[model samples]
Target: MEPIKISGILSIILGLIFIIFPVFSSGVVSIIIGISLFFFGITLILAGFTASNIIIGILAIIFGLLFTFNIDAVSFLLGFQFYIIGIILLLAGIIGLISDTQISKIASVLIIIMGIISFALGGFSIGNPLYAAILIGVCLIIQGIGMLLD
Candidate 1:
């Protein structure tokens, strides 16, 4: 019922999908990320709060368009996905640990571990998106469980 629980459920479902159909999920993830970035870029540009924001927004838009339009680029860029996910998870864990958020200490640690694992996997399988998809799925499942527990 809560937002966290809802997120957990969605994460678990997505994780299962990723594990079941790594190839499909990988492509879909790339497209989804592309679309999200596109919209975020649009928002940033519209906001025009600062010059840096506008610059980053333009870059985001360019990359978003590239990712959305080119599947080949997505395949090649898969290696970076792990690093991005790892950094995000690491930051989330650190924030959770520092702040009184819904994420408990244990969950935060788990997230941090997942982040480290993601980085390791990325390093090992820089050119393999299928492996990355499966690993990302496993990490998502663990993160979902952590969220549920929290």
Candidate 2:
């Protein structure tokens, strides 16, 4: 159990590194995801055929077809994934504050602060994404320069 847990943690660390780097092989990730989906769908289709289940077979084929054909949907799905994660965190913090101890109460406070920041960013984005983008870029540049000077 410890070995499996450690392996899972290591996998997540590697995944975060790949995500955070200035450059990443998005195409490679996409290809891997597609392959997994394809295999999963194929397995489902085979199972459906064995059971003479037309609906399951059709769903599998449709999913398989969509995996490659619907790139935009894939992007949307990934974006939605982030949003869902944020919501989950927000919920957890709220729940923890009610049910847990001193540390969790503080965590909720920090989470609330982060949620406010996210809201502000989204509010600014609503008015002008270009302006928000430029502000973010400039902020990053300034921060990078400050870090170097330090």
Candidate 3:
């Protein structure tokens, strides 16, 4: 079998485990999301030129750091941060629309979708990590499958 096919199978299996696991903790979830946001923010900071992109990157970095280093206060702040990020994303999307590049608009749309999801999920009181795990796992599985197809 090809390596990509093996990777896809592994990703699917891992995703299933994360979806089924009951013992995962919130801290783990926080870290997972935090790291992802941190890197994503960095990528945005480097990729875009608009003010909204910079603001969103800064906000993402702040939230990512908070979740990574201080979980105690994150529960209270998560919802607010997510809302703020969502707004920033919307702003960025609007700004991107004004630009001539279709790639910018496409990326902005994806960011907006992610922001909306984050905003909606910010208030969940239970199984936060499980939710993140499942979402990430699904993404990984999809990516792996794409690689295999490629």
Candidate 4:
């Protein structure tokens, strides 16, 4: 098999593992995000004088503190971001549907489906981070399979 195919196969296999054991992945991801946020926040706070926007630096520090100290809040914040993205996608899909183009319609439907999935995942993430992780894992698995086929 070609290198690309081999890479795809490996991606699929890794995705499957993530899907099967999502809690571990979620935990690990959460830790990494928390640490990153914490450090970034510190950086912003320390370098506030250099930032073009003072508010941005302050907000970053606040959010960084929140993510570092409050794991549940971090989860909810991430979920909220996803929900916002879904809402944007949903709007785009609606626009595509209104355009009446055949290809656009198909793309719109797929986008709408993705939007709904993202909305649901956001809700699930707020309720249970493990479920959110599972959703992400499933998405990765699907993408890997698509790549393998291509």
List pairs with backbone clashes in candidate 4. none
Q: Could you give candidate 1's per-residue lDDT for residues 36-117 as a string of tens digits?
A: 6678567656744556556656766776776667657455676676576566557656655776655589987997898898
Off by over 4 Å in 2: 1-89, 101-103
The TM-score leader among the candidates is 3
Q: For model 4, how does the per-residue alpha-carbon lDDT over 30-144 read when each residue is reduced to its tens digit? A: 5554565456445434543433224444554565555446557455565464464466457556655775433358887997897797688788887766777777678777877
Model 1, residue pairs in steric clash: none
Per-model TM-score on C-alpha atoms: 0.59, 0.39, 0.63, 0.49
**Total clashing pairs for each candidate:** 0, 0, 0, 0
For model 3, the local distance difference test gives 0.64
Q: Is candidate 3 or candidate 4 better by lDDT?
A: 3
Off by over 4 Å in 4: 1-3, 32-54, 57-120
Task: Compose the digit string of candidate 2's lDDT tens values, residues 59-94.
Answer: 434544544454666554432322332343354456
Clashing pairs in 3: none
Candidates 1 and 3 compared by lDDT, better number: 1
Lowest lDDT 10-residue stretch of candidate 3: 121-130
Residue 134 CA error for candidate 1 (Å)? Answer: 1.9
lDDT of 4: 0.63
